[model samples]
Target: MALNIKQTAVAGTMESSDVMVTVKPAEGQGLVIHLQSNVLTTFGDQIRATVQEVFSDFGIRDAEVFLVDKGAIDCVIRARVQAAICRASGEGFNWKGEDK
Candidate 1:
């Protein structure tokens, strides 16, 4: 079972996500991603797919992401994750990809 995720409201055209995941103390640390979004405009699948793709680029596994959206595009989500990952790892958002 998983914990219920809540929304974190903010003003902007951003598609943000709150990710929480754990690494095993031992071996075989698998990946886990929990995504929740209020971006109810037939764009949930696209957003989810984009997030997964971005995560792969950063070599991040075993992370849960909860997203609450309000009319946001896939680009926004990708941007948010890029920013969050940069902040998380104390690096930069080296995002080099075509606009979705």
Candidate 2:
């Protein structure tokens, strides 16, 4: 199925070990990300890249991503993004799995 985000959705928390990802629908355009973080000067590019990669992996071409980070690592970033996408798109994370 061509999974797609239907409306605005949010995932993750604003705690120390998490991040908040807000995704909203967009037209025929690419992903536009607005990142807010304490380490923007240090890890900004990496964070944006990771988010973009995850979105690409899920075949997401159009959306607006607003990420409020709280010192989350790459893995956490991936998880949060995936969760937000699933919540927004209403698709589960069993697309590329072997078993439950």
Candidate 3:
């Protein structure tokens, strides 16, 4: 069920308690994740794991994912990832902001 990314797309904002997620088409490479966050020392592993799980759930095996975290929680990470994927794939999706 892996879907190819059509183009670069971004979701969310670099605001407090939120995350900005970007997805782009990658050739040959599969799911490269780059994450930056203030809480990386304490939460890096968890955040990375969560993002990877979200990608797996959406069947996204080939893409370059870049995310900037501003103290976002797991659910926010999931929502932003989903929204970015939808936008990159040209699917209609609206992220209702924080509460996701």
Q: What is the TM-score of each candidate against the true structure?
A: 0.57, 0.91, 0.88
Candidate 2 segments whose C-alpha is farther than 4 A from its true place: 95-100
What pairs collide in candidate 1?
A: 31-62
Measured over all alpha carbons after superposition, the RMSD of each candidate to the real structure, in angstroms, is: 8.7, 2.1, 3.7
Clashing pairs in 3: none
lDDT of each: 0.50, 0.89, 0.88
| Model 3: per-residue Cα lDDT over 1-100, one tens digit each | 4566899999999999999999999978988999999999999999999989987877778899999999999989988998899889887654443246
| Clash pairs detected, candidate 2 | none
Better-scoring candidate (TM-score), 1 or 3: 3
Model 1 ranges with Cα > 4 A deviation? 1-29, 95-100
Kindly indicate the candidate among 1 and 2 with the higher TM-score.
Answer: 2
Candidate 2 worst ten-residue window by lDDT: 91-100
Per-residue alpha-carbon lDDT of candidate 1 for residues 10-77, written as tens digits (9 for 90 to 100): 22333344322221211134334454556545766786688678767776664555555655566666
Candidate 2 lDDT, tens digit per residue, 1-100?
A: 4569898999999998688999988878679999999788999999999999988888889999999999999999998998899899998886555243
